[model samples]
Target: MPEEVKAHITGVVFQVLAKPGDTVGAGDAILVLESMKMEIPVEAPRAGTVSAIKAKEGETVQEGDTVALLE
Candidate 1:
């Protein structure tokens, strides 16, 4: 099964820390988001291989928007 990582706040994608096929463990930081002058980390919810990235650096994303997927 694949897991989608969603944004918790409306923000700009500050950085992408993982690429497709990258291995990630639960709680691993996958990306960073900047919102309201605060930096928030988007972490992996489960251990899996990164399957897709939907948000890119400088891209704007809203709360609940899927930023990446893992399988």
Candidate 2:
């Protein structure tokens, strides 16, 4: 099954740490969001291969937006 990694808050995507086809463990940081002068990391919900990155660096994302896909 595929899992979606979502943003927890509205913010600008600061960095993308994983690319498609990358293997990731549970809780591994996939990206970071900059909001209110703080950096928030978006982590994998489970161990899997990173299938896609929906958000890009410097892009603005809303709360609950899917940032990446894992499978």
Candidate 3:
């Protein structure tokens, strides 16, 4: 089954820390999001291998948007 890493708040993607085919653990920072002048690290919801990146650096994302796919 596939899982998703989602944004917790509306923000612009500041950077992508993981790529497709990368392994990640729960609480690992997968990307950074900039909102209200603050940079927030988006972490994995659970341990999984990254299957795809759905958001890019500098892209705007809303709360609950999928930033990446994990499995």
Candidate 4:
């Protein structure tokens, strides 16, 4: 099954941390978001392998937007 990793806040992607084929644990940050001069992490909801990254660096993402896929 595939799981969607979502952004918790509206922000521009500051950096991408996990790439496709990378393994991550629950709460692992897949990317960083910059909003209001602060950097926030978009984390994996559960332990899984990264299948895809939908957001790129400097991309603007809204809250609840899918940032990555986990399988």
Per-residue lDDT, model 3, residue 28, is 93
lDDT of each residue in 1-71, candidate 1, tens digit only: 68889998899999999999999999998999999898899999989999999999999999999999999
Candidate 2, residues 1-71: lDDT per residue as tens digits? 68889999999999999999999999999999999899999999889999999998999999999999999
Candidate 1 TM-score, true structure as reference: 0.94
List per-prediction Cα lDDT, in the order shown: 0.94, 0.95, 0.94, 0.95
TM-score versus the correct structure, for each prediction = 0.94, 0.96, 0.95, 0.96
lDDT tens digits by residue: candidate 4, 1-71: 79988888999999999999999999999999999889998888899999999999988999999999999
- Candidate 1 lDDT (Cα, whole model)? 0.94
lDDT of 4: 0.95
Taking the candidates one at a time, how many backbone clashes does each contain?
0, 0, 0, 0
lDDT of 3 by residue, 2-69 (tens): 98779999999999999999999999999999999999999999999999999989999999999999
Model 1 error, position 39 (Å): 1.3
Model 2 residue 45 CA deviation in Å: 0.9
Superposed on all Cα atoms, model 4 deviates from the true structure by an RMSD in Å of: 0.7
Where is model 3 more than 4 Å wrong at Cα? none
User: What lDDT would candidate 2 get against the real structure?
Assistant: 0.95
Q: lDDT, candidate 2, residue 23?
A: 100
| lDDT at residue 9 of model 4 (Cα atoms) | 94
Model 2, residue pairs in steric clash: none
